[model samples]
Target chain A: MVEITIISGKGGTGKTSLTAAFAHLASNHVICDLDVDAPDLHLILKPENEYLEEFFSGHEAIIDQNLCSSCGECLERCKYNAIKETPEGLMVDLLACEGCKVCVHFCPVGAIEFPMRRCGQWYLSKTRFGPLVHAQLFPGEENSGLLVSLLRKQARGMAEKENYNLILSDGAPGIGCPVISSLSGTDLAVAVTEPTPSGSHDLERVVNLCEHFKIPVGVIINKFDINLDQVKKIENFCQDHGLSLVGKLPYDHAFTEAMVQAKTITEYQSGDLAEEIGRIWARIEALAQLKKAA
Target chain B: MIIALASGKGGTGKTTVCASLVRIWDKPVQAVDLDVEEPNLALYLKPELSGRLISEMEIPVSDQEKCTACGACSEICQFKAITVLGEYLLTFPEMCHGCGGCLAVCPEGALSLGARELGEVLWGQAGEIDFLMGRLRVGEAMSPPLMRDVKKRLDSSRDVIIDAPPGTSCPAINAVKDADVIVLVTEPTPFGFYDLKLAREAFTPIGKPMGVVMNRTGFGDAGAYDYCRATGLPILLEIPYDRRVAEKYSQGEVIADALPEFRGRFIELAARIRELAAGDLKEVSNG
Candidate 1:
């Protein structure tokens, strides 16, 4: 199966909107939202969870105040400042805690218990289009990269079991851990970006990252009509880098309106938006087929 | 007085606002470019900081001559950056958090520390403002280390304005964690509403008081404005979508330079932020 990940140089460049549209156009695919840190695809797809799974990300330190542990020994050992004394007790911020367990290990009174913090929940759900895989990380809790990996693993397994031909994954912005995890073992990557100075600059950054992995990449310039000169610059960028510029969608309120209605652009109006997305998918399939033949 | 320019979502005028804010301020201000990875602040400021390079980060590297086939390094790592396979000590440097746990536990002392070039922290001056920018070495996995190093140079006496990275992730955390006040710059769109929730989640834990700056004011219902109203967070500024701003940004000119009127506007922004941050920061230390 071919895996296609849609990633933008930065966020809020209509990456999710494009992912939603592709989810609607690609009927024979399992959709996975890999932007687990701050997932937004679920806002449009509205999945009806068919199966729920409790996944253990990592361990978190908890202070057992009943053991009479006001010795302040744990505070000195912690380098992350994760452990703190509160009026209620010694409180640990789950987000700040990297699960190092230094406080727990150093607790002289044996008052610390280290256990798995269920930072987020992963789900296998059904949407209007097809089977979907997604997850949500608790607010302010870290380990989003782990959550993204779990959802992608489940989606790949589901695709194999159901004989699905493709997996469309939406990746987070930037070249961070989550973005790296999403790019691993992918067949192709579709880098979505705008025609602004920052957009072009950041687009080159993500492209260079994909280059390091030697992953095949494609580009889509959203709202290309906004800046005609920047459009030329982006096209030139793609040309110099040998990445295909697949589709250029005009600046339209329909994309935003579809989002407010919690519907994909393809679902809202299947005429122009869907046609453009359909063309992109056809190119992806053809490229994948060519690779398979080679 | 310290003000931080941050965006819940990426690529929404954080750097642009910081450059503009520093350009118009009358007093000497210090600009801290806290976006470690892919820091584009220098691209805008064009300051001379060639000689200021510091590589003070060091993590554990194994000396195989004295190494044993034990799994101590892999066992103690909290970031899961290290994995052991008998005699093979596989290390993924990007995931390494540099906690120095494994080094302390290695009985053979074969696990000596080695320095890796994670990124560079540059220091210079722009006009009257002392400028500091961080550029994460292209492939460096660890950003918080260099971010902390940048935080060390913050001139608390001056009006310190930080140009934070985008998104509400670890990089963003390193950018705005210690700021006396945070100004979340966002556009008016569904995507803005989506990541705004994440941005709010990021700061509430650190307990930093925040306000919102709605860029491109009339693009939509200004969902961010609605969020600000609901949460009782004040809207700091409403910068309309004007061609002049876009043209100036495209030409690599700061907003205050493009429109002289905006210089006074940013100066006012700094003043308002000073009042808010000055009051809240005192509470932060005591609380």
Candidate 2:
């Protein structure tokens, strides 16, 4: 099976919109949104839930005030500064705790309890386009990378069970944990970027990350018409780096309008934009086939 | 006062608004780019580097000579970063959370702490604004530690504007924490509204005053505005979707710099933020 993940190093670069469009274009595929924190593909795809599972990862330290002598050992040993000296008493900020269990181990009076943290939830759902696996990491929760890995594994299992040939994933922004989890083991990492300095800078960073994992990467400069000069610069960079310039999409309002209507670009309007996305999909398919043959 | 600009979604003009605010502030403002993964504020402000510091996180290293095959270290590690493989103990530095838990639990005094270079913080100046940005190492996964390092340079004596990372996660929280005012930048679209709601929920617990800056005002629907009004988030600024703004932003020029007329607008925006932060307006009932 071919698994292609769409990613942007910078946020709000149209990763979800493109994924939704790809979901509408591709067949025999399972869609996955690996952006566990603040996932937006579900906003567009409107997946109906088949099942929901709570995701528990890592641990958080709870200070038992009654059982406690305020020895301050946990505070001194915590690398995260999670244990804070509050006016009421010693408190642990769950968000700041890395669940390292140092506080639990170092507590002098056994006042600290390290319990599994219910970070978020993952969902198996059915969209009009295909089966989808998505997740939501609780606000201020870490371990998004683990959650992304779980969703990808579930997507792979479902695809294998149903004999699907493709897995299309919408990745989170940044070159961090969730992005790494999404990019690793993918057949092709499609780096969607724009024609801006930060766009090019971040794209290069993310593509380099993909290269670190020896993943073949292709670039699609969204809104290339925004700045023709930057487009040329990006094109040269892609050529020099041996990356494929998959497609150049113009700055079209239809993408946002489609998002407003909760529809894909292809489903909302059939014009140059849709045709352009189709062409991009064709290129990705060709590359995936080439990789499979090799 | 420290004014933080953030967005639930990416590319919503947090950097754009921040760069403009620094330009029009007319005072020595400290512009902090806390979006360590993609520090873009320097691109617009054109800051000249004055100094740099390598931001590092501590990871545990096991000394094999002093090590016994006892699994106490591995057992206490909640991250499972260490595994006792029969005669050898394997420590995955990448998976380590930098908590030094294994070191604390090692009875044989075998484990020692080592530094892993996560990223760097660049401090410089663009005009009157003291520009500070945190750039994470390309392959590093964690960012909150680096974010704290960047925030440590906050010069509270001057006005501070922090450009926060996108999304409503821990890193974003680290950037937005302890700010006097948070200005959430968002476009007028469903994706924008959905993520903005998540961003609001994320920061609401901080109990800091917040407002919205509606970017790309003419694009998409008015759902973001409805959210702002229904949720009692004051609209601090509304930047109309202008081709010139996009062109200038693409060229790495702040809106106030490229178009002199927008300086007044940004200046007004900074004033409004101060007013909200000072509790003078008190129009919006904040969380």
Report the C-alpha lDDT of model 1 over B43-126, residue by residue, as the tens digit. 677777744677556667877777785887677787776677867777666566666677766778878777777777789876
Off by over 4 Å in 1: A66-77, A83-93, A226-229, A267-278, B54-56, B68-74, B79-95, B260-268, B278-287
Highest-scoring model, lDDT: 2
Top-scoring candidate (TM-score): 2
In the predicted model 2, the residue pairs found to clash are: A11-B10, A12-B10
Docking class of 1: acceptable
- How much of the real interface does each model capture, measured as fnat? 0.26, 0.87
Question: Please, what are the lDDT tens digits per residue for candidate 2 over residues B173-224?
Answer: 9999879899999888998898899999999999999899888887888788
| Global Cα lDDT for candidate 1 | 0.77
lDDT of 2 at B17: 94
Per-residue error (Å), model 2, residue A47: 1.3
Q: A1-294, model 1: which lDDT tens digit per residue?
A: 878899986665789898998888787899999887678888889899988877677788888779846888777666677777889888776656777766776677889888988776789999988999998766555567777788888988999999998899999777766787888778888999877676787788889889988888889888777677888998999999999888888767787678877888887887876788788778866766665567
TM-score, candidate number 1: 0.89
What DockQ values do the models have? 0.36, 0.82
